[model samples]
Structure formats: C-alpha cells, structure tokens
Target: METIQRTHVTDAPPLPSPWRDAHVAVVVPTYNEAGNIAELTRRIYDLEMPGIRLIVVDDDSPDGTGALADDLAGQVNESHPGRMVVLHREAKEGIGRAYVAGMKEALARGADFVVQMDGDLSHRPEYIPRMLGTIMAAQAGLVIGSRYVPGGSLSAQWGRHRRLLSRFAGIYVNAILKLPIRDVTGGFKMWRREVLEHIGLNTVRSDGYSFQVEMNHLCEHMGQSIVEIPIHFEERRADSSKISLAVQVESMLTPFALRFGRRRRG
Candidate 1:
C-alpha cells in the first residue's frame, strides 16, 4: 500500500464541556484510500475531542484499504475502546451507499451528531471543532464546510478547468433545485442526528456524488435550518480521484430527477 505523508495540524485548545460531551460520530466512506486513511485517522484522534467516534466504511478496496483500516481500528480500540469502528462491505459499491451504511451505523451506535467527510484528507480534521460549535451556535440542523463562501478557498494546485467545473456544479444544482445553500455539491458537512433520522436514509436515491446535492435538497425541502461556514478546500493528500465519467453523468442527471421525478419525502 502507498503511504501518504501530510503536515499535521497543531492541536487546537480543548473544546467547551458541553460540546466535548456530545457524542459526535464522523462517518468516512473509503474505497482506495489506503494511502491516506492512516494519516486521516491520526489527525482526527489528535483533535482530542472527547466523545468523538470515527466510523470508517470501506467498499472492499482492492488496494487493501479495508485491511489497513481494520488494523488501525484495532490498535486505536485497544486504548480508546470504540473510538474507531470499521465496516467492511463485500463489494465495491458507490460512495452514496457507503455513506448511507456508515450513517446508519453511527445512528445505531447513538451518535448525537454525524459528520460526513472525505477520507482523502481534502476535508481537514482541524475544522471539525468549529463545525460542531457552529451547529450549536447557529441552531442549524446541518452545517456545511463551503468553498464558495466568503473566506473560503480552493487549493492552488487545482487547474482552471477543475476549478470552473467545481464552481459550475454548484451553480447548476442551485439553478435547478433553487436551494439556498452556496455550496450545494460540497461533501464536507455535519448533520444533526435528528435530521438524518427525519430525512430517512432509505429514501435517499442518489448512488454517486450527486448524493451531496440530493441530501441538501431533502434537508431544505423539509424546512430544516442549514448553515455554511468557510473552509479552505484542499486537494486530496494522495492517490487519484475516484470521480469517474459515470459518476459525472449521474451528477448531471440527479438534479433533473429530484426536480421532475418522483416527489421526495422529508
């Protein structure tokens, strides 16, 4: 397996007692992220945020990411029992399916707040404390780490085409869905447990990256309060991206489906 090297973010000051006491479960869906998972897990635990649990859902990556995650979970659990949980699926399914499974597992495990982030380290662990604080302070059901918001930025490594594509995606989704969120396609987000329960994971239909857009639409459709905070979105720390042509096609079609297809329930 390829190992990823990353600069660790210095530990932030301890969180307030109330935020530290809440059960926060971070659900990360992985495919071929063996190069980055170990580093990612370390950074999350380094936060030293009490009551924080990481649930890694692996899609049986051929590169042995699932096994690496299992080993890491075992080692972490030896000291911090249940701090890390790994769910190994039998086949390589879509990211949406992996997230649904992980989110359900988190809810079953009694997480008060659930976080969805990438395992590739593009979604920094350092921003998590602020996200938790934002949800509490804003009284929002979902808080998104947005790149298009003021003070938000993308990695300089991103080429003009990629940057434009990413920006256009948000605009296209908003144009069709009329959602108020500035970053509709952003993957880094924190969702309150009650919101996930209300939005019924089983009712979610998108099987690809469009999952982000679909979930946002459902939250807004249900009249849930949503908030976006600025985040400097980084490129993946290692390994190639998994965004395939098929996934892109699915993304383009999902908005139309949500707008014109069957009505979704809250």
Candidate 2:
C-alpha cells in the first residue's frame, strides 16, 4: 500500500466533441446518499453532455433516497425528457447487485456507453467527459478513472490506514489476478455498450466492492481493450460510508474465488 508520489494535474483540457452526441448513461448505486444525490445530479446535468442519462439505483434507504431521486428525475424530465431514471430495490443488497440492475436498465434504455460511479460524490461528475472521450478516442472497451496512475490522487482527508487499505486492495487483487490494470478496485469506470453486453453481467457473483475487481478480470479475460486516465479522487460530500465488515470479507475472498472457483466468468 505504498503511496506512489506523482505530480498532480489541476485541470484537464476538454477532449474534442466527436463523441458528444453519443447516448451515455451514468449508473450510480446509492444507499443513504440523499445528502449528496441532488448536488450530484445538478453537477452531471450542468456538464451539458448531450444524450446523457442519470440512473440512480437506490437500495430503499431509510433516509428516503429513492423517493428523493424519483422526485429529482421527474423534475429533470419535465425540461429534458428521459434525462434521469431511478430504480428502487426492495432492500439493502450489495453494490454489485445494484450495479447489475442499473446497468441492465441502462442497456435496455439504449445506452451506447455505460458508466459506473458512486452516488456519494466521491467520483466527480467532471471526469465523466474525459472518460467518455477516452473510450471513444482510444476505441477502448473500458476507461478507468484511476487514482493509482500518474497525476491521479486520493483525498487529502484520507488518513494513513484508510489510504493503505485502499492501495493494498488493488495491489493484492492484481497480484492474484495478474491483470494489467493499475486500479483494479476503483469503482469509477466507463464501459462501451458492447463490452457490458458480452461481460455476462448476470453471471457475476461478487456482491460488494469486489465487483469492480471481478468486472476488470472479466474484461481482461475476454480480451477487451482498456484504458486508464488520471483523476483526483475526493472524499464523500455527505453521509457515512456504506462499506461494511461483510463487504470487506467478501472483497478479501473474491480474488481467491475468481482464481480457483469455477465462477471465473465473473
């Protein structure tokens, strides 16, 4: 979990507009993110990215995040029809299941590209443009907003232990899976529609943050082109983290399962 020191970039030049009109879907999985969802929605729309859709998958949070998201989606659709969507699940499953549901919805809605990001605002909306541009420009099946790469950084608010744990998770997963990705555990990623269509989403088994690792492994296993871009990771704007001890345990054992278990298609 040793921190790799690198020069940070303050502003990234906006890539060209060749892919601006593509149907892009931002699939966010939320659990008690009410304090942050509205602002997140605003920032995403404010980008003015054409054909952009926000799909908020809520796990029936006690804070009524699902209702708030539905209200927000309704408000946005009045002026910009079909600009936002909210999927309310029955209970708190795991992030992996939430993402599977949201991704399926996005594809069914005709998303040309799919984005995975946290609803807590830790994954900035501004980076979406760069990620989209990268996927199109590089013809990559996936583009990752990476903190472990050069010019990428974590929140200064993160203490030593948290930082170490995050970094070690990626290193440990890579050591076992031997994937070429630098940020195997990162949640912020952009996927071409075809990649998701072929990744066998329904077959994925991990139900926690390890979902990120499994998806990366699947993409590599399927020989999909992948790219990484530097991003400054931020601390959540509000609400407590949803990560639990069970999630941690699942993440710890996921690599072994993928390596030796019969479910490597995940």
Which candidate achieves the best TM-score against the true structure?
1
What's the TM-score of every candidate structure?
0.94, 0.93
Q: What tens digits encode model 1's per-residue C-alpha lDDT throughout 90-170? A: 987799999999999999999999999999999998889989988988889999999999999999999999999988998
Candidate 1 structure, TM-score to reference: 0.94
RMSD of each: 2.4, 6.4
Give each model's whole-structure lDDT.
Answer: 0.90, 0.88
lDDT score at residue 33, model 1, on the 0-100 scale: 91
Q: Show where candidate 1 strays beyond 4 Å.
A: 1-13, 263-266
Tell me the lDDT of candidate 2: 0.88
Per-residue lDDT over 186-249 for candidate 2, one digit per residue giving the tens place of the 0 to 100 score? 9999999999999878899989999999999889999999899999999987777878999999
Question: Candidate 2 at residue 29, lDDT?
Answer: 94
Give the clashing pairs for model 1: none
